[model samples]
Target: MLFERLRTLPLRLLFSGSVALFPVSTWADTAAKVAPDIDLKEVAPVPRPEAKAPATADQEPSPDADEANPVPGEPEAEPAPEFVKTTRFSLLGSDVLPGTSTRLAWTPGIQIAGLSQPTPVLVVNGLHAGPTLCLTGAVHGDELNGIEIIRRTLYDLDPEKLSGRVVGIPIVNLPGFQEASRYLPDRRDLNRHFPGNPDGSLAERIAYSLFENIIRHCDMLVDIHTGSLKRTNLPQLRADMTNPEVAQFTRGFDRMAVVHSTGSDGMLRVAATRAGITTVTLEAGESHRIQEHQIEAGVNSLTSLMEKQDMISRMFEWGDPEPVYYESSWIRANHGGILFSEVDLGARVNKGEILGYVADPITNAQFPIHASADGRIIGMAVDQVVMAGFAAYHIGTEAEVPGE
Candidate 1:
């Protein structure tokens, strides 16, 4: 019932920074241009203050008295500037000072027979103030690629040189993760419940707790995921370009294929956007396993995104930007048979190009699936036994990224 609490939360939850992004006319144009991978910038450590020599016994140690205790008449030293851009900020009920990082626990209210596990939240509060970017992975327990991406991105950061905060939740659904399943113990999809109902079901309650405690703290969010049901997707951004705010932030990613999607009801991206958080879903590789190439690609894009946000400065290679797909459709099997792919992921095809084929095992009947439009394959199922109308291939029609 308290789902709309984002608007009512303390104003401290709203963060600001000196570097605000300009409107993105095109997704590809949003990043700094590059051909071959090369480092152009570097992260510098914070300069330490010089240590003063020890004073002799005769020479009285003179510390700055005025700095320690100001006179009562002298205007109360401006009380930390009331939730301003920089200074020590409080999060998760503690003051998080600049140039520091900490681990916090997110414990659910209920503790019934090992069902509730307190998840660890990694926070890196930087030396300077900027937008807060949150990276979440494994909303689905079977998804392993994202878990590694979050770990590598957060661990590689140096808090002393960071400009903004990076909050990483490596795994959100612990119940599902522990069981190696995609849903909760009760078979509820955790990703489908967001900005959840406090008095609702188990999934809803957990969703509400996370959203209220951690999710709202972000200025921007990228929910990491992998293709479900044995499907694999190219590293891409799924965003609702319809929102002007959403379009502006999607420009931060490097070389990710942008797919326009508003997201389904109760999804984290949709709820966060409704609550005034700029959000998008990042999908890479397939579920239930980790691929090195996919993980590297994901990590690169994420770091590139951070640099574009000015959160951290570092030298890194930027790949050529991929195209934006305005429309996409899944090519399904027409007959019950074993499926085999003829084209690889990211392969371009003509309207009538054959993508894959389905063959009936008992009877010698083979059916080929063709592209309905001139586009590239963005997602597809792994070769396996299939029934009639199983989604076999997904193709996306390329289009120019929309301007502001």
Candidate 2:
């Protein structure tokens, strides 16, 4: 019902309640070559920031600031992320020299009886160094939106014109992606393991390998994901605002909604954040199928983030920023049955308003599901049969919303 997206832990992952893209050709050749970049139209574009004030005569631009609180009239801009061109970069035993791209394979720590299929990792090492940015998708095997997102984002970069490196692992869990299932063959949820143990469970080993070898290579990370368990989300960022660095990292995306969660234990975001790598979980659209708008929004957002970090320069037009939800909860179903949502994702609701209803298919008895508090619907169950106590509507509030 939510993102962290463990099918078994919806309620605990919820804030205070019970439960909570790809193309073909340059669009479909995923396994063999670097994906072809598609033309993406920005959902809401933000023009490039105006030039920053010059440094004083004796001073140079400083890149490390707790928060470069932009001065009112003549504010100094936040230093763009820096990369050392003198350093060499390598991945999975291969040297990726500057101005070049490589398609490499990463075999997980999992060892099966016969042969294990290797996962593909794409890398673009830029000519002018900046930072290594990692884009991971399909941690949940059934979620297809992220895989497509990684493809579009990675292939779009030109090594010669790029500043930093971009590494994309479209399918982190190949077994789940191959079977189109959310859980691994061992019935374990891969999302629950992070910075894994070499001598631990299979899921743990895989997590450890990725975290150690792949994830550690990045300056910042974006773990792309979508809604789970027949639910969907408006394009948004699931980030822990308590961490100063993590909080500031949320500002790069163009007007994407931010949901504050210190994040559940063992999630890649929490582990990576703990590892001192600024990371955020991006939740977009639903699982199982490809959604066009979601992919475009993801591509645009990633592009904007790179530009903000001075990794790329794409002047995307952006809208007024969206508010960050400090608190959120899942409004669960009191009666299990065929649930019909009366409201849509991002719909504003008043306290006690009927967001949807559950109707018994047999007796035709119906019960309306009302909001426990005034808020906006950020995620909800699709028109499907759900059981009592099932997380049906996810309401996010920035301070009691509009209604009392």
Candidate 3:
């Protein structure tokens, strides 16, 4: 009987497992007969494959997913747009000639330095499409090296071979240049006014307009100057070589005598540099007069710069240039008197050499001025009488020389 019940029990239990319960009277009798040796702890529920859990707020993102599909609470990355290349936008248009280059000019404008006086800037264009470069001269009216330089450079160039545009303002400060004075008609130093106010003083208006219009339009600039009033200088290029691009472009000026001048604030070079232009300042000859050697050197440097920039295809044969690179200092007069120079401009002098003698005109007493250090006499006073603290000359010394 028991064996027969056991065989049928599983069949009944399989279908009735959810609700199956024995009656109390029968379950008690069955429990008495059943063995107590079976272990419930030995049996474990079988583990089916776990279903995937829903994504949570703190879930990490997958590596392959696009950044746009960022996980919740993730910060998105935003990048700035890339820079676009510029095209030829010259004020002056060029005539396209077969197998030749293009020539251009700046849009002429009147700079109101005073109520009655006006200044003009002449811009030149090139045949090819490249960066705009500005060549400014006669900021100090007496410095004529750059004025003649621009003339020769323009007449000599052909447009068909040019790769970049050149903007030449032969006389930036026309009033000063015309009057042969270093300052404007207002007696204000034009170099000192920078980023000028358009509605401000006479010097300021010109400075403001120049900064806003032409300077803002160019990518590079070259400013030419001579020594202060009576002084002179060997043909040299002054620039900050710290910038990589400036160094690259300027290095092509083979005969350029490089000077590492600590540029003054608000000066033309400083203003141009601050405006992101690589600026080159050339100091050549004495004020009011142009030397042939200086002019030759200026032409060689200008051509070399233009050629290196691929502004023109014609390569110039420049003789070897000895670049005396230096940081410079000036020697000033200690006392006011009639002056007699022992050494002339461009001459090399040793320490203690009698540079000049200052004599009291009324007393007829002489004071001998000696060279403080060994250096080249880069500049000197043209006028014999000088007041104390007046800058007589600028000396280029050994220490002034650049190491690299």
TM-score of each: 0.78, 0.77, 0.68
**Prediction RMSDs, each to the true structure:** 16.5, 19.3, 31.8
Better candidate number, 2 or 3, judged by TM-score: 2
Q: Over the stretch 11-116, how does candidate 1's per-residue lDDT look in tens digits?
A: 3332221212222233223222111111112332232222334457788634221011111232322122223323554455433545655554565453452343
- Model 1, position 104, has a per-residue lDDT of 49
Quality of model 2 by C-alpha lDDT: 0.75
In model 3, the Cα lDDT at residue 110 comes to 33
Error of 1 at 375 (Å): 0.2
TM-score of 3: 0.68
**Predicted structure 2, TM vs. truth:** 0.77
lDDT of 3 by residue, 142-187 (tens): 8888888876775565533556666677887877887889898899
**RMSD to native, candidate 1:** 16.5
Q: Provide the lDDT at 136 for model 3.
A: 85
- Model 3 residue 272 lDDT score: 85
